[model samples]
Target chain A: METIAKQGARVQLQLNGRVREGFAEPRTQLCDFLRHELGATGVHVGCEHGVCGACTVQVDGKSVRSCLMLAVQAQDSRVDTVESLAEGELMSDLQLAFRRNHALQCGFCTAGILMSCAEFLGREPDPTESQVRDMLSGHLCRCTGYTGIVRAVLEVANERKSKNGEK
Target chain B: MKPASFDYVRPTRKAEVLELLSEYGQDARIIAGGQSLMAVLNMRMTQPKLLIDINRVEELHFIEERKNCLAVGAGVPQVELLSWPRISETVPLLALAMPWIGHFQTRNRGTVCGSVAHADPSAELPLCLKTLGGEVVLESRSGSRTVTAEAFFQGILTTDRRPDELLTEVRFPLCKPGTEYRFNEVAMRHGDFAIVSLAAVIGAGTIRLGIGGVADRPVTRDFEPGQDLSAALNETAWSLDAQDDVQATAAYRRQLVRDLGRRLIEEGH
Candidate 1:
């Protein structure tokens, strides 16, 4: 006899520094899980495939494509989205630089880009313009033409570098 | 787009996974990182009855230096090897090719064995494995066996493993010192799949050339330096019977391999 199909799987993970639990179908993507179940709509789901970097999130401190991962796979893992970077409506330094540099037009891709860049900047507090461009290569933004995004990431990197006393 | 419903099981042990595979046979698919499989499932290209997730199988996650080769477990993420200093020192070609696989986010979750198993014609890992002459370990409840990269990758999105088998690890042979290597591809965008990729390894008077994306499967040729490569390159590129796709045309792909092959060999890149 075949095993009975599971109706839903119980998934418990740390979201935005808080323990969260939900029941989802086995096929539910982490992106959908975060948005529909946890109400974390900031994790935009673009191009549902892995090409668009709009669903990027931090799983155990490493960046991963949320759309490509199942919600059940993230069980017991620490997950962070773009919203986690802000403090009570106070934008992150990267978000501030993005606004100052006019980095977003429609703002559809900003949240995911912010999350990806946040993870990148955490690892590389100081990055060259080319490196910044490389990091953005995975992302797709039709509006800004990538000029402002590159500028914003560089400005943030430079500021952090100066604060850390690194030339 | 959402994937079709499928039963999921996270087996913590290799024996459990093997038992599941044996029970489910062709109806089961092993999901490592789920980077490629998820996309395929979302597209409704495949609808397996069961998805055996091996991510929690700690026994399948490792990077070890065994006598003559580097052992990369099925659960080892692609990004992990990118930062591994020893992998860079041992298998320099793979280190140079990892960045071109995909974006950092995808690389962080995509596994080396997953890419090898998916066997996309244009993937960098398979081409690199072909150039490096790696081995793939396939296991099942019956027994286990190892197949060389050349024999393992039968065609596009195809492998030699049986329905009840799983690819456990990939062994990349350490390149001898002074082995110069170069990986170059021409993609429409920076992170897109290669239209035609060239993996060339030359040193100690041996020339190994492996090309991907322009064929149903990656093709390789070993020859001596200073030998005329045009005839062989053209022959191999044409022999593969490349087809016209949105990314590139059959004629264009054939020309690309011929041109890129000669340029890389001449520049010794």
Candidate 2:
């Protein structure tokens, strides 16, 4: 009876295109909620601390650390995760460029990097190398040497610009 | 690591927050932004019986332009502060230091008052506040009291903040004419905590410098606008007794003070 009473405040989250709800402690971590509770294991948790930036996810159009946020804080909010970058195995241009450029090695840090880069480069077509570096500074990869990662982003930028008749 | 289970408390009213803090006293620990506090709990460094979730307290999250200064509420996310163009233009140093506090991920979740309450020596906001001569307003069951930056800090990782008191907001002074400012920090990476961070402000024919991560607490140096660089270093370090730790040696930071102080003074000129 007490256990039944404990589950209060069902938060409405728009994950991908579907609406989902979860009743959790106000302190339940968003990452844990996404993984253990919701079975969306695509969102990897590399560092529980904020340093690694691995658990990044889109919280209402803003990239945020799922590890650092509470599930309840995102009540009645929309969320997008790595799994949403593709739909039924179709990938976005940035995702394909990452593949074509051999950007990822271990693949653990890819999703967060992809989400952040997708948002950043979508708004910026002709970003400088330093701007790319600065924007990507937060996401860390222990596998790739960062050369392929940066190059892959440049590849996407050139391809996207050429396709759009941009300089 | 999973945090030890504890009773959760979310108080909506300021008076309710004050009362909860008083009722729990030392056994109660506040969470805002949870940047540092969450890490503390995860590490088992602190296990407060009552976890006061101040993030739900609506009054704590604000960025209002007060009569004499900018009143930044405790719950104002660090990212929101950076995104505010007016804050960037009006409080340039604070703007400059925000990105350096943590990566975008951390800043998105970190809070202004959480930075002050944790009072890490290397943290950016403390030095920014110290350099700007900001004031912190503390609220408790009794009433409110303001502590100037210089007097607010007590020692390393410590403040004059009482156990029962909650820091409600931080007040940053309005910039004056000719107020050129510079914030510089060196880390292994750009966003990592600084080995030594300096916030230098020049205005009103005076020079104000705040040094962090070089001492037990932030140390400030005030000089006549045109004072010589070497003299400023000697007075600020030797007279003030800057402390050092594992990140970099004490002597190295002292030398950095001289080098950075010289550069900032010239830049401010």
Candidate 3:
């Protein structure tokens, strides 16, 4: 028999548009729950420690270290992972540019960089290269040298600005 | 990296929080944001019998501007504090140090109280709080009392915080106009822990300098206007006790401390 964390208070959480309800341990890490329980491997865990930024996810439109968050803390929160950035058939312009620039090599830190950039660009349409570097300074990408990575974000920022006319 | 299994409590009432802390005493570990504590627990460093989750206490999440100081709640996220313009405008040193606390992701999860409560010798907030002459409010079943920065930090990860008391809020005193403050840290990587960090607050009457990562706690030196800090560090007995660790040799850190002290005095003024 599984010991119950909450009996009557059913866990009601929204994960990328789908309603998820379950009785997970209050100490259950959201990163493990997303990948093992929900089968969404897009949110990869590199350091288990919260430094690598590989397991970042958006909780209420803010990027958070998923490894440090408990499942119960994420309850009732509007969670968005890399899986939510792309629709069924097509990916966002950021993703497309990341592919075009060969921004990722091992592809472990890509999901998080993509997620952070996607959200960051939404707030800052035309981010300078230094700004992108400042925001991306936390993420560790051993393979990509970040040459193409920074370029990919700049390309998307410029594209969005050109199309939207600097709004 | 699985943490030790432990009981948890989420107290909504302040009275309930104080009662639990008093009852549990050493067995209970209060978690504000769980950013640093969780990391330590994962590393098998600390295994408390119970975790008192204080993040849900809504009352401890405000940034109130007092008449003489700013009262920042312990449970307030660092990211939330960053968005508050008053915090940035009033205490520009903290605004400068806030960006280097960790990263955008970690900042979202880390709490100001948690960071200060942990009281790591290398952490950013502790140095800033110490330099700015901040005070922390401690609550227990009995009552509440405030501890000054100079007397608050006891040793490495140790504080005057009683076994039954919990840190609720931090008060950073207001500096007069034209107070030139500068904070700097030399970390291995951009987001990695600083090898040696320095925070200097210069005012019209005096100049206070804080150094972290070189000692077990934030070390401060007082220099009245027109005093030579370069000659002062060598004379201060406390500077002689700077310790070395795996990050950097003691000799190297001491050298940096002396050099940085001079540089901070020169540049900060």
Candidate 4:
């Protein structure tokens, strides 16, 4: 195993389905690398110590705190930020539901919440209200008091379940 | 805040990791999952010259069942252990306490051994490990040693691990038949550190109660299940030397130990 110098190292990853490369030191957090070097501005950086979920992103299909993961550690991994949640101008079903419920006030925590909810609903396609709330507890949304976020997540879960039934 | 600058190495093998540890000694730090270490780094609490990333070490990513215990490797994430199919039947106490460790997002990347290695007094894993009489495996280029949980944790955020040793795995004794277990904690929020955490294991005639957050480290005491325990519980609570903090006062912590301890002991019956 070779040690990369503290000066910097080239970290390459599949970011939101695109292969992106960025130069970062060993201490550079993934959230910073994404926003600054890889042009992923949606990866919000709040409470860089991992308490606030504003830096939450998906690494290899699992939602994790980007602030807690160093860029060097995410090398060669498939990473997904909030930018992947939308296609062109088409918002994902979960995003549409959030809009309908008005789940955001300041919208600072919405990206992280959406990323977590998206990963969660994939695992649990038909979660109960309490389960949705439990998943939402990982994220902090001081503006909305979390009522609308919970409703939006539950609504997406039910819609997905019914849509799968229609098939 | 960003972490201090440091060189990084991702070792693919456990031997390579041990070699790095042996060479760097106190100047090197092994990073697994980086859930806790990253937070500490961001705060600039302790800066290491070399950061060894062991996430790619395939040998350390395992959760195997042993003769009388479950062996979890250093690479096994908390979420993986929590969702293990046999956890509820094998280690019921751990299954109950796993959810309170951290939030779902953090657990997704937080390794089980990492939390045990961190040895936070308010953490649930250490309390459970102490109560269950688990063992921690510390390996280095010199040799390997296994330390009992009772003697492994020394103080708040301190452990018996040496600078040249890596916490390779943790062995949790499997639940025995006729033994009942109960785990409870009081925290400001669902995923926050516990102000006071209690784990009770009741067997045929003996009951063992482990308390956390009120002391520098998790402490355990054994007693006869048939006897009255109020006085003993109060005495044990006061002996912990609880201190006043922003989240909780010394008196409230002691009260929690007495009240929550009694409740868990009775609930196990």
Candidate 5:
């Protein structure tokens, strides 16, 4: 517990299928580190206290609030930011559904919501509207009223289910 | 808001964590999952000189069935515990209440022990522990000691844990036969902190009720099935000393205790 001098520590993590390296002070949050140091701006930072859910990202395949985690804690882990959701200009089905359903307006909360939906849909491929609404509870959108987001998520789920040939 | 400057250390072994705790006592804070602690840090509510990250301590990540209780370690995340294969059969009350703890994003990284250690009055895990008479294990360099949930939670955002002691695990007693449980809460939104939460355990001859978010700490009482149930619930509600806050009025909370208490009791029956 001896206090050391304040300084930046080296942090390396697999971000968006790439090994990214950066330096973070002990007090640096994962969101700030990803955006400021590692240049992953897709991980937004609305509330640094974990309530706004604008900083959601995947660490080891689980969606978490980047604001609530230290960058040093994510070392050696696999992280997925919203930048990884698409394949070189091609939007993922969920993103396309959001566009088709007009799910986003301000676009400030879109990245985090998409990250959360990606993880949720990966686990539950055929979620009901209520389930999707429950998942959206984690996120706060000043725009859209969450109706289109819910519709978009359910639409993607239905599309994925039929493509997988599951009833 | 950014956290104040501090030295961070990830201890790979439980012993290392214990040693750090022993050395720093009140100056060192253990960071497991960092769900609650991070928020406080960002707000500068606490400025510990050093943060001992225990996520790398592999020995502390486990959920074991020990005789009459389920022991959850400090490193076991809430999501993992919620998804445990035998959780519903082993601890049905927890199974019924886990989803109400937080949102899916937070639960993926928040630890069960972390929430108990944080000792938020409205949190589901602490209320569950108190209602089930669970035990909390506090470990330090010198030794380890176990405290019952009732004795562990001292007040709002407080606990009986010493500065040098680390909350290593919490043991929830296994559900007994012929006993039924029902948990419900009223919150502004799903995943928000409960305005008033209630847990009821109905046994063969007794009904135990635990109430949270209406007091400084979660409170519990036992009532005989043959007694005046409404009167007893009213007395218990009055004894909680509810206060007026932004989320709810003191009178409204008391009313919830009287009404929700009755409904939960009936549901259990």
Candidate 6:
């Protein structure tokens, strides 16, 4: 077999909600592709390695580090970014709770944390405070000391549970 | 840190992957989930001439329960295995330690076989494989071969896989009926690499222990059930060539191993 040099790899995937088609270098990180190629700057890139969790995105309904994936690797996957949480200038329920509770400061890590928590809340609508803390453990937030973030998530979870119970 | 320039290939078949590995030899690297490789590449630790992405190899993607062992393909993501009900019921040790790996994000892309191939001394999957006495399957243009976890991992970030071979599957022996298993590790944070981790399987008239992060590779030992093995475990801790690094001191790791071993045994672990 012969080795080929660097070349562009075509990437076609569902971004946010629409189909997106583009070409990226085979070595391009998924976060870079989403941020630069598709203009989804919501996916932050902190500690290009997988540690920081600042590049978390939803692939096929599961949270994953966009930085650890090649753009070409997401050939047919459905990706959800922090932008998906809002609807035409309307904030999501979780986002509203964050604002109500003062969950973010500086906001550098807010997008990734929100994305991760979005996936977690989908899976576990009714979680304990410890479970919420564990879900947030992978993410790092230097601001708000995580107190307000945890409280905000807990409030939303409780509100959802009560609303469902009422129905 | 961006990765150095390198060519990429996505082969849909395992045979093509092996052929590419053989052709590129040492200049080529197999990328399964890119969870570890991407980080290494970003740091420019290794700039291979080619990166053979194996995610498209359908033949290498599967999870099967055999007569004696459970086989996990190279393409199965770590999070997928973690959520699999069979893994929780059969190989509980793996399920327990999977969450201790990076976070949900990294686990979503990291592959089990990739972790086994990388052979990080502080990694959870390799430690679990060693504890369960798993087997790693490698294939090359010449032929295919399987190696035990003990022999497959030669050292930190090293394995017995030849440059021309591709790791296709890893088989973990099923836990015997009525066996009890426990996993414990201490890291700076929830998802950081462990300073020292211990895996214990007890019951069925046998007991086995595997320790990681204290040495170049995970070490395991088997003992008779109901025997007081604290002394033996302490001896084993001191006997290992544990290194002192920034994360921890060798003396601290030694004591941790001893204490954790004794605690696990005393708690009927």
Assess chain B of each prediction and give its TM-score.
0.97, 0.94, 0.94, 0.98, 0.98, 0.96
Clashing pairs in 2: none
N/CA/C clash count, model 2? 0
In model 4, what is the error at residue B17, expressed in angstroms?
Answer: 1.0
Predicted candidate 3 versus true structure: per-residue lDDT over B137-253, tens digit per residue: 999989999999889988789999998998999988876688888888887777678777888888788778888887778878788777666678656534547666677777777
DockQ for every prediction shown: 0.56, 0.35, 0.41, 0.86, 0.64, 0.58
Quality of candidate 3 docking, DockQ: 0.41
Q: What's the TM for model 5?
A: 0.98
lDDT of 1 at A72: 85
Give the CAPRI class of candidate 4.
high
lDDT of each: 0.89, 0.80, 0.81, 0.92, 0.92, 0.87
Worst 10 residues of 6 chain A by lDDT: A1-10
Task: Work out how many backbone clashes candidate 5 has.
Answer: 0
As for lDDT, the candidate ahead, 3 or 5, is: 5
Which tens-of-lDDT digit does each residue in A11-117 have in candidate 4?
A: 99999999999899999999999999999999899999888899899999999999999999999999999999998999999899999999998999989999999
TM-score of 2: 0.91
Q: Report the Cα lDDT for residue A22, model 2.
A: 74
Point out the worst 10-residue segment of candidate 2 chain B by lDDT.
B237-246
Query: Model 2: what TM-score for its first chain?
Result: 0.90
Tens-digit lDDT string for candidate 2 (B1-269):
55566666566767788888888888988887887877677667887777777776788889988778888998898988888879866788887778788776677778888898889988999888888989999999999999998898888779989989999999888777678888887777888778878888877777788888788778788888556768767667665465556666777777778887777778642
| Candidate number achieving the greatest DockQ relative to the actual structure | 4
- Lowest lDDT sum, 10 consecutive residues, model 1 chain B, at B260-269
lDDT (10s digit) by residue, model 6, range B1-269: 88888998878888899888899899999999888898999899999988998887888889998998889999999988898888887788888888898877778788999998999999989999999989999999999999999899999899999999989999989878798889988888888889998899888777788898988999887877666677777788888888899889999998888888878866844
lDDT of 5 by residue, A17-100 (tens): 999999889899999999999899998999899898999999999999999999888989999999999989898899999999
Docking class of 6: medium
Please state the Cα-based DockQ of model 4 relative to the true two-chain complex: 0.86
